[model samples]
Target: MPLPLAPLIPLAVRLGLVATTTFALTRLVRSATHPGRTDQRAEDALDDLGEGLSLHRPADRAEDRQTNATARVRRVVRFRGKTWELDAGLMARVRLNERKE
Candidate 1:
């Protein structure tokens, strides 16, 4: 006996439909997991660098010997999103983004 083509047509249609849906879903998942769309890792790297530098002291005994060492040591950092601006003067408006957990 020969297999019926009419019965196989519905089965093939269902299988094709399922395969297309699965392919689309997998593509969406891959796009979602892409690095560009996920958490901002560069911001974390910058924060780590800043923290590491904060733990070290630069070789500037001349400035340390001065009476205005505190004034010279003061720093103003303005970080918006991924952009960062550093100012070493007074009377400034520097806003920083809150660190993530």
Candidate 2:
């Protein structure tokens, strides 16, 4: 069957736009789900960690330790457009995405 050229041109343009939009959307989702670990802190925090007891640096001062002890142990972090409350284990994972502790 022969199709009209004018209608076909508009249809092809619309399809191209739709394909481009879908491709962009997919890239966004993929990047969020599989975020690259580009920060040094995050890499260091996750480095050479195995079935051994983890070590934490001593507090800078007695006051800092006292304040930290009274503060809440849990922290809230945002990842991939979602909010996550991190305990001990999850905090390590989130720290990998930052440049500082």
lDDT of 1 by residue, 1-101 (tens): 98768968988999999999999999999988956654467444434342111222335533343222111123455666555555332211223345669
Alpha-carbon runs more than 4 Å astray in model 1? 1-3, 35-101
lDDT of 1 at 22: 100
Candidate 2: RMSD over Cα atoms? 11.9
**For each candidate, what is the lDDT?**
0.50, 0.55
* Per-residue lDDT of 7 in model 1: 69
lDDT of 2 by residue, 2-94 (tens): 776986898899999999999999999998896556877855554433433443534654334322111113568999999997644222211
Candidate 1 vs. true structure, TM-score: 0.32
Model number with the top TM-score: 1
Work out the TM-score per prediction.
0.32, 0.30
Q: In model 2, which regions exceed 4 Å deviation?
A: 1-4, 35-101
